[model samples]
Target: MTNASDAAGDEKTKTANEKAMAGSETDTTSPASPTVRTEHEDDLDDAFKYLHDHSNAESTSIDLAALRRKIDWRIVPIMFVCYVLQFVDKVVINYAAVMGINKDLALTKNNFTNVGSAFFIAYLIAEVPTGESTSSHGANKVLTHILQDISSRNFHLESGWALTCLSGESVAQRPQEQPTITLFSPHYYTKSEQAPRFAIWYSGLGFGQIIGGLISFAFQHVTNKHFKSWQAMFVFVGIATSLVGMATFFILPDSPMKAKWLSEPEKAALLKYVSINQTGIQNKNFKMRQALEVLADPQLWLLTICTICISVSSGVITTYSATLIQSFGFTPKRTALLNMPSGLVSIAAALIVGFGVRKSESRWAWLVLCCIPGMIGGGLMSFMPASNRAGLLAGIYLVNAITGTLTVIYQWTMANVSGHTKRSVAAALIAGSFSIGNIIGPQTFQARDAPRYYPANIAVMSTQAGGAVVAIVLFGYYVWANNQKDKRQAVEEGLSSSAGNEKILWENLTDKENPNFRYVY
Candidate 1:
């Protein structure tokens, strides 16, 4: 009788609080709750229901700013290290070239070209399978576990094996989708908010480049008889990367659904917050039909083609940057130091253009921005005499700025693409195109064009210009397509007006299936 009497009194008081907070969407229905769970929150996965179900006095008082800080501290270090290792591993060869890979490996005229080309070939072949695997398995799990396997193998192979696509296992893991190259976007960030957040880790590529150059320089100075400087660089980077990979797999957040750094309420809050993306947190079950739809999607093809076109210049820089510096009459060690600046150039461009366009939500404008430098650089390198070292070197650095656009392309892919299966294929296709361009990029610098390498320089200039034009055309197409959709939607809803209704943000709908979907340009 005493317990019943107290419960009745409490219920009456709770009703009053509910009535007081009725006007707020944030007010939860529970009497003690200050915030209400919207219909949207109810639709989330069971694992994340706690976000909207908080009933305590403290639930309403969560420090979102504090939560964001906590998330940043935990997430950034993992991604930064991952990106740094990838950049270091891939371009370590550029340093290796200067460290006498040609003489040490007895790489004759076509051998260097063949070696460079071969690595990408392996990379291209692996991308689609990795993509399919990732889309089927989920990026967070697959990307890490696979890297663990490869990094271990790489440690053994680095002693003698030429570095071949050491960075091929790329997928941005939609839960934390990468700007590119396994870019993790943190869907919690809106398109506008993504750049500043992502630029922090994406800038690691620059640091990695700098560190790799120093390591190469240091190794070259070692007086070893059995192992060349290049071999030492490989072994050291490989062991460190392998260990990092193992540690990261254990420590990094697998997904927001399972992030240990965040409390249950924080996880729920983060999930609810990012529901604007229209893409869900993560979906492990792969849909075959979405994969088929990717083949028919025009946007995927355009994105892939763009990657191919831009990567042509990437191939040139990746394979020949050291040789070009050597051509400038710099000693091998000096070449390593000179090459360090390119990483800095790449870093500046990534942060500037990545965050710059993200602020305006203007992807097309940024693509053009990135390409302009490449075009100018290519022209200077093509027309200038090889003996004009400063001018040619300036061109090398300028061309690296294009690396920023590659991240933009990745961001664009994550923004416009829908459907897990199709996105997986899209990642593979875009990455594959990167390989194709790289393949073409190195071939342009044929033995025939060796000393002057005018043809390769021309290729870089023309392709970048071509890529920019294509980007503009694609931009126009996106506008045209959006207008058509708006018109069609207004008609279907029996309204003369084109105002949009609420979209079903989750449900894993394909872009074609969802009429309410809008593309980010």
Candidate 2:
């Protein structure tokens, strides 16, 4: 009886091995045309039948423990540090502008505004290409190269700025006439010089974000100190990012299936894990037509619109929160300290919402929740202007909290998108919209509204409310669409309802394909 059972088990194992080998061959030999719609459905059908009907529980290939072990540690922490530093470096310029950098440079009001707007302009132009490259290559490699290039690009610019500062300081002390060097002119200081300063800073902002989640993934054990700026933060970030890039060459896997860090048992498990959910590219070809199809999705348009509104609304405060607070009666140092809390609020909000979305498997809840504080903050600051100082401070903190939701927007897109090209393009477009909004937001803070900027506040309040409404509506659409999909799949597959909660749709994979993929309201 024992020998008979062993022989039967051996036969079953042999058959399973043969099937897996055949599947491998099929995947490798499949047509390169995404439009071909090759054997994916057939393979899925077989996988579904086996998992659904068979009692062969032991035939599964899933090992969560190994997956946890294979992930690289350097990616996530460095990414987070880089992002936080990027924001700090970007915003600190706003502080410096108000401090002495503007007066020292004698930057005309119009020129200063251009300087600010220039950051986003370069960001808008570079983002799409960078995002596309990041998508085609991996985020890690792209991030590393970008950091190196941008850092090298900025090294001389910063040195020039520093020397210019020294010259300015010397003139300030000696009370001499300004030199005929024409620092602002294209001949003396070209766009090649000044433009990079803007580009690098904004690019750094996007760069931080592009890889921020990976930071969360790798640095689950990190603390707040990891993000703070006192410890040569920018320099550290440049070095760390470079190092991570070097290390990732060995440690970072192209995909779960391609991870060399994993054993054969672990690789199989990882593939199974990824396969359980559909992401439009089931080893599908990456094509320009599919890219265009993604672009044609209306959901992408809605996202771009929402991003613009949100950027306009939230960005105004990011540029001037400290200045606004100083107008409220804080000293320069105190203003800096006050802005620190707002920064912390943003970081906390990002982490909390990131984890919450991943755990609850609900992007809408976090999106809606984060938007509320900002909306309320904007409203309170605008309408309740005569309120207590503490209340005003609370409002400002909440406004800062809005900073992290950009991550929610991107992650939500990533979760919904499976096609590599589509995700890459969509992320860049969304980022471009954000840059446009940022450029517009700060410009609205005219000199006439120095202290309070009541008109700007009102505009921000309106936009924040608009953003909140958009989030709620999008959430409802996603829920309804998810249900419709589950129903369709059930009826066609003729399979008993197995909780369709894990269903991945084509529209979801396309980044804009699904009318069902509501924006992260």
Q: Against the true structure, what is each candidate's TM-score?
A: 0.84, 0.66
Tens-digit lDDT track for model 1 on 412-463? Answer: 8777777666666776777778878988888887787777689999999999
Q: What C-alpha lDDT values do all the predictions have?
A: 0.67, 0.47
User: Which residue pairs does candidate 2 place in steric collision?
Assistant: 76-214, 76-215, 471-521, 507-514
- How many residue pairs clash per model? 13, 4
Model 2 lDDT at residue 172: 22
CA-RMSD of model 1: 9.3
> Positional deviation of 413 in candidate 2, in angstroms?
0.9
Give the poorly placed runs of model 1, Cα more than 4 Å off. Answer: 1-61, 136-138, 153-183, 494-503
Regions of candidate 2 where Cα sits further than 4 Å from its true position: 1-62, 69-75, 156-253, 280-285, 383-389, 483-521
